[model samples]
Target: MRRVFMIGGAITKFGKHTERNLKSLAAEAISGALADADVAKEALQGVWVGNAAQGVLTGQESVRGQVVLRALGIGGIPVVNVENACASSATALYGAGALVALGEMDVALVVGMEKMYLDDRTRVLSAFSGCMDVEALPELTRNFANQQERVKKGMQRGGAKKKKSRERSIFMDFYASLALEHMEKYKSTQRQLAVIASKNHYHSTMNPLAQYQNSLTIEEVLEAPEVVWPFTTPMCSPIGDGAAAMVICSDEYARRIGARHSVEVAACMIASGEDRSKITESTLSRLAKKAYERAGVGPEDIDLAELHDATAFGELYSTEELGFCPLGEGGVFAEAGHSTLGGKLPINVSGGLESQGHPIGATGVRQLVELYWHLTGRAGRRQVQGAKVGLAQNNGGSIEGAEGALSVTILKA
Candidate 1:
């Protein structure tokens, strides 16, 4: 198989891009990545764009990659569009990497863009729901609402009370339900969840490109609005917009057209959550194992990681699943600061999607951008010292509590 290397990667500051649409967002990120990699746009053989809800958000579906490519002034090259909810971007990355590995293309540009805040909250909420298995999610919302009512009652009784009107992301409600089960099975606590949130917040502060650049105290995270029992607003990802793009090329291509930043794609593995039940799927465990198998390195060999931490609970659960910590001990791991920078193996130095904001299709690629900086030692304040091996795990969709679509990538300098 041909070796694939990341020649360049970039993402727009991930938040509400009220100033841009999908095409403009794609152009900006692609332009930045191409410039960063020191490659001309014309050098790219093809482009792949990963997105979900754009059709609902803007009525532009097929040929999305072509439309965006043309708008960006890049000509004639083939463009592909992929969607797998939040995993859409990872899907794009996989396609691009496959192209290089197959020698079908020497260089490929993979981009992920999503615009969610175009309409009011209801419409945005509607679009968000559309990302799920449509049939199951509508029923899930009722279940979420019902559960939130119970949380509200507990709040009325002064158990984790906050004075604001509570809201729950449909995913969170599903997560909350799954998390509550995990808590019960594993004897987890809200404090443990807070530890995860606080850790990501602290790390995000070091990331200039992160959406939330300030640290949050454990107390502040714990005291935030309770969206679901055992989950505060601080623990959840926000609705947002942005774009991420990467230039993937062959090893020879990189040596011929060198750039200041070059991170080798040591291993790239894509897996799905099929056998793992929603209640049983350990997102970290399954995803991490596949990554290690492909990368020829175990979790302990990893110096740092950019994980799929869409919520504080996700950070906790994913850590356990990823083998950084034993099952049911992720909370203990977080409280010890093991996942923070300067710890045994720091994770989410980019603040994660929790603070970085999960812009659906853009999120997976953004995780790669974080991993790129760590591998190349470009993540200044958040740099993991002497880091040579880095891993990134991005999973989208939920089969119960586990991720439906999953990817793990190992990068090295």
Candidate 2:
């Protein structure tokens, strides 16, 4: 099979773009990617777009790619729209890689975009439809009410109750429960998790496209207002608008296309939770092992990484499961500075979804943009010296146990 290579990639600064519509953001990213690849628009054979919440955010449906591409005067070529929740863009790049490897296309443009700050916060959040079973939603809401009732009783013993906004961000409750359970089992503290958020904030200071570019000390991060029990507001991924894109093609095709830099795609892993327990710890275990086998490289071989951190605990548990740190050791690994700049293996130098803003559909592709810069020594202040390989872990869904959708990609310079 032909090896797929990323010729170039780009991402727009992630932030709230209440004024800009979805297509404008998409065009900005695609135009930048095309210029980076040094390829004419007509040379592209196909396009793949990743979007998670356009339907709820913009009332747009399957026509996302068509409309977005049309804004750039590049349309009529085959366009594919991908929606895998937060893994949307990862699947987009993986699909582009597959097409190039299978000889289906000589060149492909993969774009991931989301304009999440469009509707009111409450309305836009309803896009989390994948996390629930529609058939039992009525009962699930009832269960939630009952669960809250139980929580109220438990809190009453301490004269406490949940705020209305607390109930608004119900998914945080799920994530908080996971974090609480992990802490109970591991003796992890809020300070340890705050380090992950703090490090990413500092890392973003070097990232021009990052939303949170200001530096923050661990003390400042830990002192921020708590979003949940252990999570502060700054410890969570921001909601914003942005686009990320990469031009990928076969190695021979890349040389023919004459792009400046090229990175090989060694392994791409996609896993579904078909037969698993809720919060199963097996996704990372099984997927990372398979990825290592396919790429012939282990976690220790990675120079840097970009893992999902929709919340602080994401990095905490995911790093452990990916074997970068032993079980219950991710907090220690993070607080030790191993996951920060100048560390053994830096993670989320694009500031991650936490600081870069989680434009769900655009996030996975942005991870590649971060890796592209790192492997090519273009990450500026966030660059890891002597870096030769990079990895990204993008997961989504909140059913049963842990994250439901898992996608892992390993890249080599």
Top TM-score prediction, candidate number: 1
Worst 10 residues of 1 by lDDT: 160-169
- The TM-score of predicted model 2 comes to 0.92
lDDT score for candidate 1 against the true structure: 0.81
* Tens digit of per-residue lDDT, candidate 2, span 1-413: 89889888889989988788887898888989989889888888999999998887667897999997887888768898998888898998888889889998889999999988744767666776545454655665565556546644554223334232232355565667778778779988778988999998888888888888988888888667666666777788877889999988898998875779888888988877554555455777888989888888999999999999988888888899899988999999998999988899898887887898898889889998889888988888778998998999998776654566789999999
Model 2 error, position 303 (Å): 0.3
Q: Give the TM-score of each candidate.
A: 0.93, 0.92
lDDT of 1 by residue, 266-332 (tens): 7777776664543365555666787788877888898988887777877787777778878899888
Residue 137 lDDT in model 2? 53
